[model samples]
Target chain A: MEIRIENLTKAYGDFKAIDNMNLTIADGDLVGLLGPSGCGKSTTLFMLAGLNKPTAGRIFFGEHEVTDIAPEDRGIGLVFQNYALYPHMTVEDNIMFPLINRKVPKNEARDRAYEMAKMVQLEGLMKRKPKALSGGQQQRVAIARALVKKPEVLLLDEPLSNLDAKLRVETREEIRRIQQEVKITTIFVTHDQEEAMSISDKIAVMEKGVLQQYEVPQKMYLNPGNLFVATFLGTPQINVFDAEVHDGKIYCAGNMLRSGCMVPDGSYKGGIRPESFNVTLLPSAPDAIRAEASHVRMTGRELQIRFNLGANEFRLLVHSDMQIGVGTPFYLTTREKQILLFGQDGKTVGKF
Target chain B: MNRKAGNVIANILKYGVLIIGALFTLMPFLWMILSAMKTNAEIRAIPPVFFPSKFSLENFTTAWKAAPFGRYLVNTLIVTVFNTIGVLITTILAAFAFARLNFPGKKVLLTLLLATMMIPSEMLLITNFITMTKLKWIDTYQAMIVPWLASVFYIYLLTQFFAQIPDALYLAAKVDKCRDFKYLIKIMIPINKGPITTITILNVISNWNSFVWPLLVTNSREMRVLSYGLVQFQTEEGSAYELIMAASCILVIPIMIMYLFLRKYIIEGVTQSGIKG
Candidate 1:
């Protein structure tokens, strides 16, 4: 079930959909192909399923090369974005279609289909057509249909994107549970960063038909290789300010914050997570970002204060017990380890 | 109060036009039934009769005996049924290829197939007759049936509908190892029930009403369809208008029943196919 994609590329005339991609997904590993729309994530998934032929490269499932094989012969199961259930078929029939296609005995196929449906927890609605079921239910039917054949690798394209917010969370957790029980190597494609981070063992982040970074979720969050990866992963995104290192000191908002910076003497982008900032009444604290608070709002237990530093705006999370009025001058400090320093080329050159 | 009155007036105006249109359309049918039972004197009157003074079976008996109407019924049924089945087979195959498969000159070939529809069937009558003669298929069922086998219009209609099916479903079928022909029969045909039914009803109707090609190729009384036998209603002296009307009624009733049962499919298929075309 280990998939190895080497030097794969798919081009439409002169425009490449996937460009020289390389990755190795270990057996039983759940990998997420995460990217924005038209970023070639689906293209990579399709190539792995053998639904699309790579322009130049080879794909190996354990030992055999499946680059030129037919899709059915590739031992892969694929779920589409809209679920793609046959409208004419009841849930039972839809789930049983793959088994029947393999020429399994009629009753045996029925038993396996029922078993898979139950695994996906679609027990009572087997007689209803796709239109009769809810979006999450139809998606379950699609999953059952794909897995009834016991494919070595399961590929799902934006499987939970059609569900409501609450349903999406429940369905994703359900998918993770099912994938764990089956222990089949699976690739989940989505544009949502939180969903990818929550369920994936590892993520292969793509951009403009190229692989930007491939790493574990926690490592990718804390240590992004480039500005794009840092910005793409967190909500209320990582705030990046124009900064420079002068005389081995990091300077921002017309003040020196830290000394002995790792990056050389040059302009750089300094990224700080929203939760990494500290706010206080002290305006002259050392190694702090100086700003004037514009607004303060309470969200549950955390107090969020909006502040302006020069022309750019940023927000900080603080303890809700402390009362801070608007238009108050404050100093914000991000721990040195929490700062990400990027070079002129938009890539991290200094970790601290 | 004014709005309610305006609504009532608008409703009346709308239904008044619709009811008048329905009666106008039904008038010919009313006239045909009335004339079939009327005496010749009433039929030849300055104005047509609305209803006969006394209902009579005289015209039905006369029309039934004048020609082999029973034999013509059997012949027309055989030709229409076989023509419809054959045309469905050929057109579905051709349309599936045009819609799903990719090959060299596919666009040009489809454009040419569509272009052939503009050359009215009348222009091909002589050439087809020559072909029938060369094949020595004269006075045979093949001449009548084979000439209408491949229809460009039906192919285009089916292809347009088939193209609307999502490419993802086709890929899913491919992954399930369903071959092209199996996909057509099991997936495409079943899901596109509307268009297929539309094609079947239309094929039966057009073949049932066919006149020219059957006239050119079939001359014997045994080979003539219902339309050809209707010619027997006329002679060099004068045309028998009453018996022809009676025969017309007999000929149309079966097709009417068929349409009544299949009108839902016809409307659905026409509307679905009409979206793109």
Candidate 2:
């Protein structure tokens, strides 16, 4: 189902939990609602699932307005963060519960439950209660239960958070594969940027109940609409510095990082990805900005070097062969000529 | 070794105090049984005879003959069984509503109901009696049973248990198209078996042992409960020690049997609910 949310808002007394959010998820498109905790990603997901009433909005599944519909009538499958599998029931019964309520024939419900369980690799564990299963196994049961009814839209709320690191990876892969096989329009809410990037066709980045950007994972990284989106969607974080643009040049820490850019002369926040910095030990390099390495961590094949630019610490990810150490002076330059600039209002300031 | 000895001494003191308390509690039942078999003079004997010289069934026969004890037992069971069913129904519905449903005045209503628990039963007794009389329900089984059918304390207890159920499960049920009442009966009630059993046992006990209301309302012999008979056994002439003791023995038996059977759930329901829920 194609879910279109129009001006959705949820206010808890004076605080707006979801502030006038609008998003369009196309049919059979796997979208990820990515954000930090309390960023209203889950609230958006709940509104889409009809689990929560939007304080102000119209939600549509295809062309039908379903904003006022009950959760059971919404035809959306929701897997909760904690799984929320009925602890008393066996896996088979858990999956079959919705089917039974729909008044499907007994044999057909059982057959469909078997198929969902098998799809999630829980075939032999149908008789086992959720408490007796491992976290990963229980997660599979939750997925199977949610999918058994063959819902048109699948909603998952941090479905992998309860597992250990290894299990999270494995189960997320399984979820991705299952979602593909089912071809249901799946929207999963997650605080993990990497998970969203890894599985989503389009990732909607949100902060403080506002939608910052909605684009493909790589595009969201390459071209963020604001400072928060740029900083939020990368590992080791994007480095930001307060700088001024003048005479077609962007100057930061007494160096012109980018020139021939037609941005107006004004102070702007500068952003550079950790992987974008080029490190050279030679101090008198013109294109490179100099800083003393305060810390160097050799993480397998890559060296994570940390330095101070004034009061803020800056991090750079480079090849381990750079042989950088603490207190070593190195000059830095961006691999790309144009640095990302955000104005005082926090929106992207200029053309690339 | 010194710490081990101290632990042993502490354990001994704990069990020693517990043992003494147990005896103090059990003493009355034992004394009643012993006195029931004795002659009237023997029961009144100073330094009250620990044991009867001759164990006789005479008190049982006399008590059984004088007041139609069998009919009283039957009448009591009828009231108790019906009242228990009624209370369980009312309690489950009220508890579920209090635990899950959102409506105006929920907080204020809950506080008011809790406040009602603090009012002594004695304060409401006269008002209840007047109501029963006005309804022309006095001396009726419905009069005896209906007035005590709903208990705020039991509803409060079940609400605590029901509240402990995750909202996630409730949402999950809603997704599966299960109605609220169906979820309550199939999911909530069965899962909280310990608390439900506790409520049933407690209701049965209160109804079985009810004295003041039954005594106040029922003037006829046919409508009397066992506790009412026990009061009747004591005449205005004097207390009939032998018959009263025998009647007391009969009343305690059923309660003891229920306690023995459901003691684990009772203890679990009473203690675990406050912290666990």
Candidate 3:
């Protein structure tokens, strides 16, 4: 099912959780609602699901107008973050709930539930209650229950946040696989950038209930729309330094920095991902952006070298096992393609 | 030896205090039982008899024969069930509304609902009695049950439980189009078993013990409840003490059974709800 949400707004008295938001989700597209907590990604997803009544909006599923439709009639599957498994029921009963509610034959509902349980690798645990299962197992049961009705759209609200890190990765892959097999129009909400980037075909990044940027994950990572998106999308985060344009180059703390088209007109803040900076021995090239090595820590695969650059201690991720000492001056180079410059208002100024 | 002996004496004193407190609490019921067994003359003796010289079941027979107790037992049972069921239904609905839904007057309505709890039950008796009388519901079951159809304390209890439900569950239910009358039955009601059971047990016990309203409204002998019947038992012509003791025992038995079954829930409910953080 293709979902089109237009001018969706939800207000709680004076506070507007979602404000005139609009987005189109293609059929079979595994789109992600990506943002920090309370950014209205979940709110938008809820409004689309008809769980929340929009203060003002129109929603369409394919050609059908479902703006005011009841949630059960919308034929959407929802996987809650806490799973929301019917604690009173066994796994089989939980999965069979929607089917039974629809008044499907009892035997047929059991068959469908069994099939879904198997699909989610929860076949052997069908007789047990949710409280008896592990977190990952319970998550699988929740997924199976949601999908048992063969819903037209699947809405997942931070479904993997409760899992441990190793389990999160494992279960997310399972979720991705399930989505691929089902090919339903899916919207997964998460504040975790890595999780969204790894699974989603398209990501709708939001802030303060406003749609900041909606694009494919690769494009979003390679080219974020604003400082928030840029800083939010990267782990270890993007390094933002205040700088100004003078003599056709950006100058920072009495040192020259690389200038792309962003420097031509005026001053702007520059963001560089930690991995964007390459460090080498001082003797390799004397004229590089010079910094004093202050601290170094090994990260198994790479050395996270903390160095002082004009009273600011910035970090660089270099290949592991290069013997380096404190107070040793090193040359740091920024990747031209990786540099992101933003205006004072925090919107993307231009690429370097 | 000195310190150890002092510690032993302190432990004995603590136990002695607890046992005395327990005996103090239990003395009323024990005396009621003992008085029922004693003759009126024996009951008035300078030193009350703790145990009758000769046990008798005579008061049990007289209490039963007086005031149609069988009918009163049925009346009390019906009123308790109807009152509890009514309170449960209304409290769940009102609580769910306050916890989940947004309406124009919701906050004001909730404030008003909670405010009713502060008004003492005795203060409402005259007006409530007048209303029932005006409605021609005097001596009717509705008179006994309708006034208790909604309880503010029960609503507050269920509302606290309902509010604790994760938003994700509501969201999941909504996405599936479960937000109608169906939502109450499917999502909200089923997930709140703990509070519902706790409320049901509480309402049942209160309704069973309730005396004032039933006494005021139920003029017909058939409309009298167990508590009213107990009053009637006392006024029997030439009352026998042994029969009254047995009657008191009978009245106390059902309460004991209910408490036995719901003891944990009662304690948990009190601790969880009685204290405000």
Candidate 4:
């Protein structure tokens, strides 16, 4: 089912948790609500699940407004961050609970639960209680219980936050697999960019209760809507510098980095991704800024080199085979397309 | 080696104090049981005997025949069982509401309810008695069972336990289409087995030993409970200390047995609440 959230707002006294957020999730698409803590991503998920009421909004599940509907009637399956499995119930019973609540016959409910357990690879563990299961196993049980009812939409709230690093990766892949197999429209809330980017067909980046951008992971990474989206999406972070645009030229720290920039002449913020910086061992190169390497560390297949240009420090990712040393001077250059300029108000300027 | 010796000495001192305390508490019950097994002459001897000269079952037979002790036991069990069921129902509902539901003035309402705990229950006895009289419920089972159905302390205690359940579970239940009462029965009550068992045992014990209300309201022999029946037996068999001791043993033994069997749950309940709180 497609979901449309129209002008949703949730206010706690004077504070608005989600402020007039509008979004439309396509049918059977796995989207991610990505943001830092307290950015209202989880709040939006709860509202979608009908666990929370919006102060002013209309939520539609395929053109039927369900803003006032109760959570159980919303036809959604929500997995909590901690799994929230009933500790007193065995896995089979837990999965069968929703079916039984709907008054399905006992044998049918049991069969459906067994089928769900098998799908989640918990076939042999149905008799065990949640406390006896490992974190990953418990997570699978939660998913099985949520899916046994065959909900149209599946909502997950930081589902892998409780698992270890290796388990998180594995479980996310499992979740993606389940979502694909079920062909359900899934929207998972996550603060981890990699987790969101790895699984979501589309990512909605949020900040301070407002939607910043919504696009495919690659588009969101390569062409952010604003400064926040740029800095929030990438690891090691995008490097930002105070700059001025004059005579259709972009100048940073007294160097004319790019000319013929199609933006009005004024002060602007210049951003460059860490991997966008090109490093050269020679002391001189065309339009290359001189930088002194301050730190170098090998990270898997890439070498992370932190360098100093005048008074500012920056980092860049290069092939691990490069032999770079600390305190060594090098020339740094970046393509014009890699440079992102934001106006004084933080919105992206004209395209490169 | 010195630290180990100090630890051993501390252990001895701790257990020594505990043993003395246990004996002090057990001495009166031990005396009652010993006295019950003695002959009348032995019990009333010029110098009291710590142990019976020869144990006899004659006092028990006499005590059993003296009054309708069996009838009293039956009456007590009926009142206790009914009252415990009523208490469990009322307490669970009230505690769940207090712990989970949101409403205007919820805090104020709970505060007012808790404030009733400060008024000594003895102060309400007359009012309750008058209400019972007005309702024409005196000398009836409802007279005893209805008045004590809801307890503020038990409600507060179970509220604490219910509140410790994560809100996520409640939300999950809500999403699963489970109603509030069903969730309480299926999840909350079962999850809190220890605390519920503790309170049930405590309530059963309290109802078993209740004296003042039963004595006040019950004027007929057929309606009297065990505690009141024991008192009546004492007065009727005055100066027959052996038979009185035997009757006392009969009244107190069941509660002691119950406590002994279920003492683990009681301790677990207290510790769980203490640590969680």
lDDT of each: 0.88, 0.88, 0.82, 0.90
Kindly indicate the candidate among 3 and 4 with the higher DockQ: 4
lDDT string, candidate 3, A307-327, tens digits: 765655577787887767677
* Predicted candidate 3 versus true structure: per-residue lDDT over B146-242, tens digit per residue: 9889989888888998898887766665554455567778777877765687788778878887889899998877788888766654553765555
TM-score of 3: 0.87
Candidates' DockQ values?
Answer: 0.65, 0.64, 0.45, 0.83
Over A1-352, each residue of candidate 4 has an lDDT whose tens digit, in order, gives 9999999999999999999999999999999999999999999999999988899989999978999999998899989999999999999999999999999999999999999998899989999999999999999999998999999999999998999999999999999999999999999999999999999999999999999999999999999999999999888999888878899888777777778877888888888888997778884567788877789988989989997554556789989887788887778878659889888789988545
Model 2: runs farther than 4 Å from truth?
A: A12-15, A283-286, A298-301, A350-352, B1-3, B54-58, B274-277
State the TM-score for model 1: 0.96
RMSD of 1: 2.1
- Docking level for model 1: medium
lDDT of 2 by residue, A3-61 (tens): 89899999999899899988898899999999999999998988888888889989999
On lDDT, the stronger of 3 and 4 is: 4
What residue runs in model 1 are displaced by over 4 Å at the alpha carbon? Answer: A283-287, A295-305, A319-326, B1-6, B275-277
Candidate with better TM-score, 1 vs 2 = 1
> Candidate 1's C-alpha lDDT?
0.88
What lDDT tens digits, residue by residue, belong to model 4 across residues B81-149? 999999999999999999998879989988999999999989889999999999999999899899999
